[model samples]
Target: MTAFIENDVHAVAPEVAISFFKGIMPFDTLDEETLRSLARHCRIDFFPKGTRLLTADVTELTHLYFIQRGGVKAFLEDENGEVTLKDFRGEGAYIGALAIIRGTPANLNIETVEDTFCFLLPRDIFLGLIEKQASFAHFYLKSFSEKIVTTAYNELRHHKVTRRSNEDLYLFSIRVGDLVKTLRKVAASATIQEAAALMSEHRVGCLLIHDAVDAEKIVGIITDRDLRGKVVAAGLDFQQPVQTIMSTPVQTVLSQSLCFDVLLKMMDTGIHHLAVERAGKIIGVITSHDIMLLQGHSPYYLFKEIRGQQQISGLYPLANKIPDVIRGLIGEGAKAGNITQMIAILNDHILERMLTLLEQELGAPPVPYCWLLLGSEGRREQTFKTDQDNAIIYSDPEDETQAQAAAAYFKAFAAKAIDHLVNCGYPLCPGEVMAVNPLWCQPLSSWKRYFERWVSEPDPQELRYATIFFDFRAGFGEAALAESLRTHLNQHIKGRDLFLFHLARQSMETRAPLSFFKNFIVERDGEHKNRLDIKKQGLTPFVNFARVLALKFGVNETNTLARLKALRDGDWIQAELWSSASEAYELQMQQRLVHQLRQIEAETIPDNYIDPADLSDLERRMLKDAFTVIERLYGVLDQMYPVT
Candidate 1:
């Protein structure tokens, strides 16, 4: 490669510095103040071909390079004085992250592939930024450096690849207003032909429809499909008002809302486009096309497909495709929790759609009701498609006759839902903790009474059942009902010494299979002999720990990691312990998921029984470390809420 400048000729005008970093990774999310600081420290450097920018044997690292316009290649040196090309980095690529994070010498040699213009950050500033900015840390955490390079190389080597935009990949913190830059608008009085013309001119699929009387108020939206269907299919007048073809109440997301939640709402509503409202006024529009990550077979698409199904037959195909989605996410190096969380959300969509189908078949219900999820589903952590652990809480009727009628109505509803779910591959919950069971299906008043009874006067059996239900979330209908129930339970049960004591006692039933000495205590004499049930042994202990911790500290988050973060943020637990628990939980979940995926690949039923021997030296070490963290947390639990 050739360059116009030498090492000494490295600098850029201050005016264009911020704009230059606006679309780059790790820099796009930084604020103006931070960006200025970066600009102050940053310098522009040009390197020629065969230039040794960094060497594998260097004792120290000095700069972090961001490729501006050309490419850089990384090489690994062998025992001989020769080096092999390990990976290549193109535009927007980052180097020196591994060295900076490790606080050690550079591990690979980096050279310009061509005349490369690079934006360079001093090693100290780069380290400081990642340490202070959680977003920067998380981006690196979510990506594997070498793997990223490999993916880029493969895509470069093969066919043309469509890449995610800077906003989609790195602008998780930046708002919709920042995302879209401009809001497209149309008057409600505009004709269909006029709206189509406007859309065509703008090269957009949809426009936010404004109110006729109040121009500032966004009342509805019209899409290209709206014109094609609501206009042409129905043979409507071309001069007719656009409001007739638009979708109303306008599913609006706050302009300040993060892109993740924005995508989630789009997924949940199956609305491909949404209007962004800032301070109660429409400002911009965002679409599924904008967020390129939501592609084929993604959770969002699956949920949208689920919502479209009018019956169970169509749902089978969507539900069956879930495993493939999970596999795809795993292949993409998505976080284990994220894959499970997406699965949980998709499963809820299936149930919600099924409930909608049932309600339609049986007609509207007699009262307000909430369909609650229990166990892993409630906690938002699920792997394999599993049985239903759900219950219903309906509003109490006035008299005994009305109660009987209400019971009759819900009983029929529950039976159909359970059977439908079973046909869709979600088995009827084995423990009879299903909505079809009268005991689990009860009036809202009855639910309150039951929770009070369970906590105030606990039994071993009731405690076991209570633990399963405590992680409650609404899958469908009246989500507020679920939230109200949680608030009530927390108000009464949190910090009640006697209740927490019993709950802790019940939670301690499962023990971690590994010891601090790094020895595995495998089950010796069963169908799964010499195999450890990692879910029961490794995960259950952490679950119990989180449940008790959340209850004790009044943290309302149901997920284990969420509870730990809440506790740490609230100063209820030390940072060291919280970090340990969080890491340990992730490690266990990741290992369990890999094990299940292995089973699926082998064409065998996926399960929790894992042999320590199957794990590598690093995995074995991680498993031990995770177990040790749990054991320490257990010791803390034993001290705080001693059962004996």
Candidate 2:
């Protein structure tokens, strides 16, 4: 009886190990018996720090190792004694899975960074285990498929970044040099009056001072603040030597450091100015104000400055510069989505500036009001040339005269602002769905009544209007005002199955770009003839699909991509399908950016069309793959909301 009990205990140990493996591995098909057999043959090994598991010369070896704990760094050492790290791997991941499965020599050296425990299964044992168990084989196949997908995605991203042709490197160098203050030097013996006049004439804040006796030595610095505080405040003569008042032991930055790094250091040290020095000589000076301005002044910054501006016309110059700022961000390789969000935020600032000016011109609102951004602007996804789609919502005043006065005031302000925005490059909405429209500019109660009408009666025209307006995001004014509107909509629409079905049907109006031959179908007419309508065909389907799902589920997030992700997380959509849809959207956006960049290089305006003849074979193939994803998503939409 004692011997039998011991045998049972030993037999169960592999089952326990298999359970642990099953939890982390991506195989849903693996059964208990198959896992037990695989686990019994897997040998657990412990290695101390510096233990190398594989080397570059080890070819034709087929074995897989799973790290249970500790870390490993895979790297390649060159003949020049330089080492480049390939990747870092930690707990629950298999190393050599790719190479082992492919029967190739290790492309990288893997060594333990610390004492590590890992399960090692030889190729023959792994194959034998899989052959005996159908479930185990299925899991292995799925794992391999996932790895291939991941590798493809990574390669795509790498190609996208590398194709920019060193533009990022050149821009980074210039920005860093400017931030580090590399320029010409001045003398310490210069008079305060001379320094102040030079600063004013050059429109510079600080001047670097070098020693007269030793030209290689940097002695001090003088800034506009030094003139105001040290010279003027002290009631000293303007003719006094700048060296008497200039800051000594000048703060310096190395020429090689990154601009962002220097900015952080300056912020940390609370210094307004930093001098760039090379071999003990002052090269140039960078002031806090210069950094702030070059960093791209925010809407808040503009608002603060515009508030003190005596003339309303002063806001125009700043508003005009918004497009240039956006171009600068794009040149710096800022993500498109992030750039759009920043633009939207800054647009709000511009709106606030206009509102402040208007308040002075027209007085405060007779009732509390909110200015709502609609359509893509409301979604905070405006690019450089997005049009105005906005409305006004205000609390209903008890007095009819007071309410009419408030509406008139807001409408006038909005009309003026819209005209300015058009001058600033944002065209007016073609449909005139703007706050200046009396129907759009309404009290909160009227807005609710309009939405209720749209929700209760599911007509085609009304559904189209609701689709645009439902993506409303607060641009300027009391956010609670927009929230109140959202709350009312949510309450009325939740469990209103008819409204959702209509929305779903309307969303299906735009089909995916896939042709019968699994190729992208190009536009037949209009300005984009023979070219793909990327925005209309590739992006809108996903965006519309996400929007309808979000509305049905009552997910309030406005960004299209965020809405899709939220729906997936809530299990309203499958994870794999949503992931594929997101990848397709990203690829489409990336192609658009590349086209836009080319147009910029050619000094022409960019558009959303991409001619198939213009793309490389690889890009053409990738675009097809992306279209396939879109088609799959459309299938999901059709299944969920079939058109009668």
Best by TM-score: 1
After superposing candidate 1, which stretches have Cα over 4 Å from the reference? 1-184, 187-193, 200-203, 209-221, 224-262, 275-284, 289-294, 642-644
Per-model TM-score versus the true fold: 0.69, 0.60
Candidate 1 TM-score over all chains jointly: 0.69
- What RMSD does each model have against the real structure? 8.7, 13.4
Q: In candidate 2, which residue pairs get closer than 3 Å at backbone N, Cα or C atoms, i.e. clash?
A: none
Q: Point out the worst 10-residue segment of candidate 2 by lDDT.
A: 1-10
Question: Against the hidden true structure, what lDDT does model 1 obtain?
Answer: 0.77
**lDDT against true structure, model 2:** 0.70
What would the TM-score be for candidate 2 when compared with the true structure? 0.60
Q: For residues 1-20, write the lDDT of model 1, one tens digit per residue.
A: 33223445477765466887
